[model samples]
Each structure stands twice: as C-alpha cells, then as structure tokens.
Target: MDVKRWLEGVQPRPATATFIAEALSRKAGVKFSLEDVGMGGVITPATLELGLEYTAAAPKVGSQLLGLTRRDLAEDPLAVEATVVPSAWTQPLLTWLLSRPEPLPAGNGIQVNVGDSDIRAVRMTTQLFMKLDFQFGGGHARAALAQYYVRDVSPLLEGKFTEAVGRELFSAAAEVAQLLGWTAYDLGRHGLAQRYMIQALRLAQAAGDRMLGGRLLGNMSHQANYLGSFQQSIQLARAAQEGSKGIASSTTMASFLAMEARAHAGNGDDRACSYAFREAEKIFDSRNIGDDPEWISYFDEAELAGEGAHCFRDLRKPLIAQEFAGHCLELTDPFYARTLSFIRLVQAATYVHQSEPCQAVALATEAIEIAGSLKSKRYLRYVSDLCTDLAEYRETHDVGRFLEMVATKYPAL
Candidate 1:
C-alpha cells in the first residue's frame, strides 16, 4: 500500500507515540525487534519518496525488537510491523554523491558504507580529501580544508576500522586542520584557528592516531611560540613529542621535537632544549628519512637544521644557530617567505645578543629590506624588535633615516 493508505489503515491508541520512538531510538541498530525498521519501514508527512523509514542497525537483544507485536502489524497501530526509516537514512551517501560533479557511473564506487556505527570516520575523511586532491593541480596548494569534511565525514569513522586505516585517516584530517589553522592564523583569526586545531586533535585521538595528535599539538605549539607563550608552547610541544614516538614519519616527528626545543629555549631551559634538539637530530640518521607520511614529507634535513638553528639561538648558542641559519638562507624557496623572514630576524637578534650592535643593525637592516615586500604582522614584529633593540642608537643620523624609512616601508607590517 502507498504510505498514505498505510497510515490511514493504522490507528493509534489514545496514547502518544513517545513510547515507540524512545524504544526505537534506544534500539536503532537492532534487528528482529519491532525496532528493526528494515522489516518494512514507513515515514509520515506523506512526502518522503525514499524506501523504508529505518533499517536494521543492530540485532535486537535476544533477537527481539522492543516496540513491535507480531500480530496485526498492518491491522493495528502497535503491530503495524512496518518500520519508519529515519530522515538520516542514506543521507551520508546522498551528500557524498551530490558533492561530486561526476560520480562514477553505476558499476562500482569506493564510498564507505555506514554499517551500524562501525564506520571509521577518520579514514573516510582522508580518502575524501585525497581523492579530490587531483582537482587542485598541485604546484603548491595549502592543505587547509573546510570543517564540513571534518565534521561530516567523521561520522563515517566511528567504529572498528583497521589500525592502519585509523592511522592514515586521522593523520590526513589532522594535517587538513593544521594547514587550515595556519592560514587562519596568518590571516589573524586566532580564535577560529584554535578551534579547528583543537577539534583536529580530538578527531585524531578518536582514531587512535597518536602522531596525528602530536602534529596537531605541534601546530598549536607553534602558534603559542609565535605569540610569546614560551612556557605553554614548550608544554604542548613536549606532548607532541611523546605522542609521535612510534609513528612512520621520523622526520616530521623530529621536527616537532625540534620545535619543542625552540620553545624550551624561549623559556631559557637550555639543557632541556639542547637534549631535545640532539634527539631530533638522531632521527635523521635513519636510512628511510624520505619514506615518511606524505603530510610530513616536506620536513627535509635542511628544514630540521634551520629549526635547530632557531632552537640554538634560543639557547644562546649564537655560533651554532648562525651556522644553520646561513645554510637555511641559501636553501630556502622564495615562496616560503614567512619562514625565511623569521630566520632572518633570528639572525639579526643573534647579533644583538652577542653585543655586536653594528653588526646587529646591519643584519636587521637587511632583514627589514627582505620583509619590505611581505604582508605578515609576524615579519613586522621582527622588524619592530630590531628597531626596539636599536633604540639606543638614535644618536646617529642613520638611525633617524632608518626609522623614517621603516615608518614608510612597514606601516602595515
């Protein structure tokens, strides 16, 4: 019978439908219970064209559904043996299918089936983004993705997926959030960026993806370090290091450890900082440095060395920091302007710390020139540090000339 005819045939007793609904909700996945809507589900409102209002999500306890009576299902309201498929039915598939401009023609597809709270959300999330990555045509696409995929796709990764699947998915989702967080951070939306990174961390945890969690923590630590929260940054970075110990990507793991060292330097924990850096350096000695997870493949030896330089500068080891900094300066790409600018500022600071004020000013001047064309407040902050450090040198006309030029050149920095 049509839904209208079926509804008309079934009559409710003088009570609310609440009892049945609550029972059904509690037993949403059950089969053989009146709760098993897959037996013959139906919907109200007479508008839904989809088949079945609900489906069997799980076998009922003792093989019996709670709300249904065997007799008079079509003849009686309580026995109406028909299930009402929830509005949530196949919604995930429909959403996924629609998101694509060209879904595979009806032969076969790779869409993960939602099976009774058994879908591993993280793995599906990674696959969704990776499959579509071909659309971006990578010269250099930032890996930050929207929260829709994180929140929606995560539902697919809830249950007992394989360990490898969990690891891969969580790692990808975390990377997406980290990259997006970085962009948002660069754009100055501190609060929104924090939310995404934190959520990324939670998803990583759910997927048992410790390294992914570590990466998320590292992302947060970097932001904290930038904001001058040296103590907080160190704490977060330490947590990242601990979480990433056994992951496939030693290089990325090592970089996180190095970032922790940098934070410790900010906190003036020189011994702690040095030890961490040494540990990070040892990871590079492994033969398979290049065989890490794709998300962290960018953390080459040079990048680690550059970061080590920053850590050393924090530790007051000027000579070591400068050695690495000089190497990084030669190897860096122009597109990586912000990191290069940061390295330059640190070099200038190193000079200042060493009390070579003239050399400091010279190096700072050069850094300012490079920063002149960039639009990062972070870059400007470094320039301002140079100016502040050199405030005592206002005696010279060159200082006045420099300040005037800085005012014109970095007004928005």
Candidate 2:
C-alpha cells in the first residue's frame, strides 16, 4: 500500500484509515480491530515511517532521524503496526555499527554546559520508567521513554560538556535507551528492540561502563533467544560474561550465566544448560548485599529461580520446572503485576506439560486476567503460547472452553 507515500499525498478518509490500520495489523503479527485507528485525525506519515524505521534502527544516525520532535513522537500518531519486518538496521547494521569508530561531535556547535544535576535527572527518570515497565509492560513505557529520550537526553549527547560529564550523561542516556529496547521487546517489537539495545551498548561503551554494556549484551542475547536465534544468543551472552568479568557483581554474573543457560536449553543442550545454571547459582550465592549493579539488582534468587523454571521447562522436565516456577511465583511481589503474570504463565505451561489440563487452563485464565489489565503484548504472547500448547487437547471440554475464553478475551491473538 506504500502507506508513507499515500499519506503524503492524500488526506486519510475513514475507509483509508481502516485499511491502513488493517495493513499495520497484518505486519504486526497480530490482528487489530477497526476501532484502533483514530478517525477524523490527520494521519501523519512521516511520524509513522519514523516509528517503523525504528524497528530496524541504523547503528549511527546520519542525523538524529530528521524532522522528529517531542510532540510528534509523544503521541505516536502513526499508529504503526507492531509486526513489520525489520529493515536494514538488523544484523548487518549492527556489524557496521560495531566496526565504526566511536561517536564524536563533528565540529564545535552551540555549547550548552551540561552538569551532574542534568545527568542525575536523566538517571532518575530512567529508574522511574524501569519500575513502570516492570509493573505495567513495555507496551506502555517504551513510547514514553522514547519521547523523553529524543526530547531531553539526545540533545545532551550533542551538547557541550566536559569529557567526564559527557561520559556520565551518556551512561545515563544509555540506561534510558536500554529500557526503551527492553520495553519494545516486551511489546513484541523484536527488531526495533534490537536496534535500541545495540545503540544503548554503544553509549555504554562510550561511558566506559563495561558492566552496563555487558548487561545490554545480555539483554540482546535474551531477545535473540526469543527470536529463535539460539547460537547468536549464546555468543552474545558469552560476550556479556567476558565483558563484565571483573566489573560486574555476582548478581550480574548470575544473570549472564542464566541467559546463556536459556540459549543452551533452547538448543537441547541440557548438559551445557546445567553447567551454566550451576555456575549462575554459585556466583549468585557468593553475592553480598548491595554488591550488584542497580541494573541487575532485580536478578535476585527469585529471578534466577524463574529462569531455572524456564530452562527446565524447555528441557521438558515438568516436575522440576513446576517446583522452581512455584517458588518464583511465591517470592515475586504483587506490585510487579506483569512479572507475576509471566511467572503464572510459566507455571501454566508446566502444568500443560504434565497433562494437567484443568490446572493449566485455570492458571492460564488467571494470567489472561492479569494481561487484560495491562497493555503488554508480551504477556499476551504468553497467553497465545498457552493456547498453542493446549491445541492438542482441544477435544477435551475444558481445553475447548479455555481456548474459546482466550479468543473472546484477546481477539487480536
């Protein structure tokens, strides 16, 4: 349909808006209802293209995505579908980005003296968004952070600051970028999330924050695994392990090892997965209070246990997976509604593997209810997976009802 070009030339009619929304749905990997498109509002193609372009982000911006602004991005008027195929900003873009020299200002421009307070404010905002992301889901937080990043943080990078201050600002900005990537991933925007994470890694590197950079790599690995690129996931995890060898705390190391374990489990390498799990536990037990980086402080025993359950589930060890998943559910806080929902889904998957269809359906129902309250496509993805697992048992009355219930609750699924 060449939506970008079409919108440039014609005002969007109701039928055209509906058509565009449907087109976005087809691209997003999920269905979208006609009501999703805003009628009577002018469709902004440039903004839409920008959002779509982010799905496959370039390593280095020739210029900060020409003609974007806080207001234009803040509302995300393009209503771009989430499922578009990533463009040039995928693997090749990452390769070129890594091979390129570090970013340096081209020439002296307007010097807006940046200070510690400015950097601190950015970090604080990042922390707040991180908490929000945990509670609600990436679907809600990603755009908010992106808007702020473009409006507030991006300029600081190009502004005049001392080398030390610049590094600090970059570090803070990198954290924001990392969260944006993570939230994007949570919303099922894998390619876009990858680009954001890679950019975050570069910013972290410029800040000399090896530990943060390593975490970013681990995050990338996590996404790669989700995308079914297990070998690439393993390589990225190993990079995280090596990159943060001395600088990272026990909790961070545990996270890296757990990520590697997941990739191994995905590959059916139970033995290798077990090895990584053991090392993760050993390092995790060795941690002292407050030793972990703020970024990885969430990788506590509960988080590790959840990962353990995930690994064992992938290995088809239903009993062991259930045990670990149960522990995670118990230890996780209620305020982390989205995390709790995911853990519940893991528990449900374990039940399905055990042939406890009734229990699985019940747990899945609970997860869906949780998902219903949040805007998280990732949580819904879990629900969709649960439906897939239950497909074999469709003849059972309970399973059939469960599937029907899910379809009713999430038509987009």
Candidate 3:
C-alpha cells in the first residue's frame, strides 16, 4: 500500500496524478494498494475505506475519497477510451457512509470557523456565478470561483460545526465544485474539468447526496460525448441512471437518457438512440414539479430539444436538426445567451449540411456576433468548427465574407 511509491513509478505522469498522490499522501494516514482494494480504478464506495477507518485522531478532508487502481496509479488514469460502466459495487459503501451519525473532520492544517449562515452565503454566491456562466460564459466566472474554492471553502470542510451543519456545508461545497467542473468544461479545459468532476463526486458521496452524484456523472458523460469518447459517454450516462435509482427525479433521469441518446447517436446506433430519446421524452412528460430537485429543474423541454438538435445533426438529418434547433431557439430564454449561441451554431451547421451556404453564413454571422459579447471558450469552439466546415464553401460570396469577418473579428477563434 505504498501509494506514493506506486505514483512515482507512473510513466509520463499526469499533473492530476501527481496532485492526487501528494494530496492523499500528505492529508491522510491510510494507504491503499491496487491489489488490496476492489474497484480501485473508479470513484466508488470502496474508496470510502480510505477515510472511514482513520482513527489516528488526525483530521482529514471530510470524507471525500479517491479510487484508482495500481495500474491507474502507474499510467495515464484519464484515458477514458473504451471505459465500461462499473458494477454497482459501491452501493453498500454508499449506504454505510450515509448511515454514519457523526460528521467527519476536515483535513489537518485546515482550521476555519463555519456556520449554517456561511454555507447559505456560499450557496447564494454560487448561484450568482452559475447565472453568469449561463449568460456571460465560464471564462467570466471561473477564476473567481477557483480562488474562492481553494482559499475560502476548502478550509471550511475542517471547520468546527454540528453534524447537520457539516453535512449541509459539504453539500454546498460539492455543488460549487460541480459548477467549477462545468465551467472548466465550458472553457475547454477537459482534463481539469475531469479532475474537478472526480473531486465533486467524492464530495457528494461525503454529503450522502445521490442525486448530485448522478448529475456529476451525467456531466462527465456529456464531456466524453463531446470529446468523441462515445463508449465512455454511454457507460457514464448509464452509470448515472443506475446510480441515482430511487433518488433522481424524473427530469433528471430524462436528462441522463438524453445524454445516452447523444452517445448512441455518436456510435451510429440510430434505433437505440431513437428508443432512448422517446423514453426520455415520456419520462419528461410525466414530471411533477413538486417532486423535482432544484438541480435538475433546468432540464425542461427546451433543453431536450437542444439534445434532439445535436442528435439529429450527428445523425446526418439536417432537416430534423433544423426542426429541433428551431424549437430550441423558440423556447430558449434570452437570458441564456450561451445556450442560444450554441443552438444557433448548430442551426448554422445544419444549414451547411443542407448545402445552403448563404443561410449558413447568415446564421453563423449572428452566432458569432452573440459569441463576441460572451467569454465562453465552448461557444467559440462551436464557431471555430463552423468556420472549418464553411471553408468548403468559401468560393461562395457569403461564405467568403463570413470567413473574412471571422478572421477580422475573432482572430483566435
């Protein structure tokens, strides 16, 4: 169980790997080995053993756990290609952790006073950043969050508090960490996003929040799909579905199903994608607002339409893509500027697929203009992809003008 030794043996070590090694080795006394642990490569319930058995009186980082195999410890752990959904081995562990009556202390050297009001303040501030991310872009809000997470929130985990307050505080911190992961994804920092996601999941587990954990898994699925890691995407999406089980609201399940549909579309399984999409729609239609969690309230019909647009676009159905994209545009709020820009980019790309360069140029022009007012790397990424596709039709006057405008206005896009 020489964790540091195993970590040092990794070839072409990732920065994430190094950080995990240093943090775990220094923060806790427990040691884990690949051969000694089950399901060690994943962030599962078995990982809880690391923090739960520490009785040496030294404080720890709440109860957030880290799980990685010996091989994962010795190689590139983030290689998510061909990754499969894990068996529900963590369920019993989750139950045990949730059944605990006492709140775990924070990591050694973390000394800060925390109260319920402090947790509420963090939640309110987090909501503001979340709104900014929805409207302005992740680039506008991520730096402030990164600093707050490290300097302000991290210490609060170890702060003195009653058990109820501690759990609530952990939950709040977990939500903020998830937002940080999302913003990182929006900023095109995929690797950093993955790390944040892993940490967020661990925090959720510590907080005994199953729905939040499922949402984080779903986010990972979304990122994997965008990166063309379709297998992992499906695996993660299904994992979200199964892990949440009785805990996830119907809308949340619909979101997970929608994500799985996108992964299936990426794999060219049209029938499977269609089936999942229909099932998602059915579940969404049956939603009861009172039973829904606030975290999943955003997955309404408009969001589902956006997913449909992406699915049809990937399936080479330009007409269907435009139909869904148009629906998304109609339902999207003007305040959701980033989402609107993204859907417009999809619509413009659909026009390109239809061989209508003039329409594509016009739509792309509007999307680029919207993006100009935002600081989202994700939005710019869509614009850049559209530019690459439009290059084929650059001989057309509209396309030519589009290219020139893009070069002039967004030189780095």
Q: Which candidate gets the maximum lDDT versus the true structure?
A: 2
lDDT of 1 by residue, 19-115 (tens): 4544666776542322233323222322111111222221111011111112212223322222322222233213222221211111111445333
Assess candidate 3 and give its TM-score to the true structure.
Answer: 0.76
Per-prediction TM-score to the true structure, in the order listed: 0.59, 0.79, 0.76
Each candidate's root-mean-square deviation in Å? 16.0, 8.8, 8.6
lDDT of 2 by residue, 1-413 (tens): 65675556544654566777778888997876433543324334433344323222222331222122232343343332323332322442244224333553322337566789999899889988988888888877566777787768777766777766766876787798788778878877665565566567666776667778778878877887877778888888888887667778888888999999999999889999999999999999998757765666677778999999989999999898888888888888777788778888988998999888889999888876765568777788788888999899999999999999888878998
Clashing pairs in 3: 60-106, 60-107
Q: Is 2 or 3 the stronger prediction by lDDT?
A: 2
Q: Which candidate gets the maximum TM-score versus the true structure?
A: 2
Q: List per-prediction Cα lDDT, in the order shown.
A: 0.54, 0.72, 0.71
Q: For candidate 2, what is the TM-score? A: 0.79
The Cα error of candidate 2 at residue 376, in Å, is 2.0
Residue range 1-413, candidate 3, lDDT tens digits: 45555555533223344455545656776563432332234332334234223222212333232222222222233421223222322332243234433455533334766787898888888888888888888778566776677667766775777666776777788788788778867877665566556667666666767778788878978988888888878888888888778878889889999999999999888899989999999988998878876667677789999999989888888999999999999998888888888999999999989888899888988876766579877788888889888898889988998899888888886
